[model samples]
Target: MIDNIRENNAFEADATRDEDTMENKFLTFHLGQEDYGIEIRHVTEIIGVQKITDVPDMPDYIKGVINLRGKVIPVMDVRARFKLPPRAYDDRTCIIVVQYNGTAVGLVVDEVSEVANIARDQIEPPPRTSRGKSSRFFSGMGKMGDEVKILLDVERLLYDEERLSAGLVDQA
Candidate 1:
């Protein structure tokens, strides 16, 4: 019994260490010319762009929902969310499925770059000067090599009082 307990404790320790390592990893994707990243821990999977069924009265950014293997999930266009000019979706476009507040939300991005391991020390807080509407979605700026990736706050991006009150998220 004591040996079994020791083995279980060792497994738990290894799992904790794995989680800690993942915490520093970010899944980088692009919008247009700029790169953005979200914590890898929150990412579930990446799929190619698919047909979206529009939901009425929702925000323009919320492109609609998609049936992902029988499960319906809301899809949000990152470009539209940022109020950026629309572009044609091509083969490079991808839908990054991520968990947001227990709900699965698919973020439509231009193209996925790579999974980058950005240490905590390499991350800097967002600037306080800009009061842009989209600024609230920025969590930090991660420095990797000669480039910086705009790290996003996934929860903040997905959460909206209007959507919650309308039960739109719950519908998916």
Candidate 2:
């Protein structure tokens, strides 16, 4: 990870409070057994469990769309996107409203974890041995005490040019 930079606004403090504040807040979420976090700055809002309007003729990962205060935001099942086994949604299922590439979209996760204030020193660059598959989307792996959090490069994660070409949604 990049050298530990210091910036603490108390905006995204997590359950593990440390003396060294994070430069930014990471909004953590779960996908199967793994834990992931994206910059809280990219997060627009977190809406509770809601009725998802299923749109026909779409990918399985596409859970359909939802009316977010008038705007129709598509919700993607992260578990499906990651090719994990499908499971029923429970109380932990939450929609994370993220604004990327000039549009707002909701990502459905197994559960919303917590906001973590990760320091630069706590983050390590994705190992070259990552096989170059998940490397592009991950900036680094963060060492959050006993639990390690995968730090995602938000822009690359959602706003992929190839994904846009799929005609799913105009990411422009």
Candidate 3:
């Protein structure tokens, strides 16, 4: 599977190399009513509700792992990770699959909104300080038709070295 993807580097390289595709648009989604947007490039596809197999000793936000075809990927509850109130998942709920740092992850979100082409100018710096352990999760904020969308910093969102690995020490 990974080999096929690497083989397709020609197409992927073009997007990265081409100035036209360098700054492509992103698909924004909601967690706790707040809007957030990530580069569409990272997004694979949004999947519907699926059975989650709980893994022991992970952060509260790390719901569990799911078998997507053949690969076992971790799924994170965006709301829980951000310390927001838990909400019930419905038909509109989705798991946004993204390729981050070469690994595929599914971020559980409340609902996905529309796709907007927000230019570079529209993204403003995120507040210097936010009510969280790590403000680095968000790269900045973007405004669209009076609505504020938090532009996430995918790299930072994963935090650091030790936390990157899914083999977390059992919190049990």
Cα lDDT tens digits, model 3, 1-172, are 9889987997787766764663747789887768898888788889997999999999898899999999999998888877788999999999999898799989999999977688889988988754564455777788888888888877665554255455442211
Point out the higher-scoring one by lDDT: 1 or 2: 1
**Inter-residue clash pairs, candidate 2:** 1-125
lDDT of 1 by residue, 1-172 (tens): 9999999999999999989989889999999999999999999999999999999999899999999999999999999999899999999999999996699999999999999999999999988655566767789999999999999998778885455577753322
Candidate 2, residue 149: Cα displacement in angstroms equals 0.2
User: Using alpha carbons, what is the TM-score of model 3?
Assistant: 0.81
Candidate RMSDs in order: 4.9, 9.1, 6.2
The TM-score, computed over Cα atoms with residue i paired to residue i, of candidate 2 is 0.74
Ranking by TM-score: 1, 3, 2
Model 1 RMSD, rounded to 1 decimal: 4.9
Q: Per-residue error at 7 for model 2, in Å? A: 25
| Highest TM-score scorer | 1
Candidate 1 residue spans exceeding 4 A from truth = 1-11, 160-172
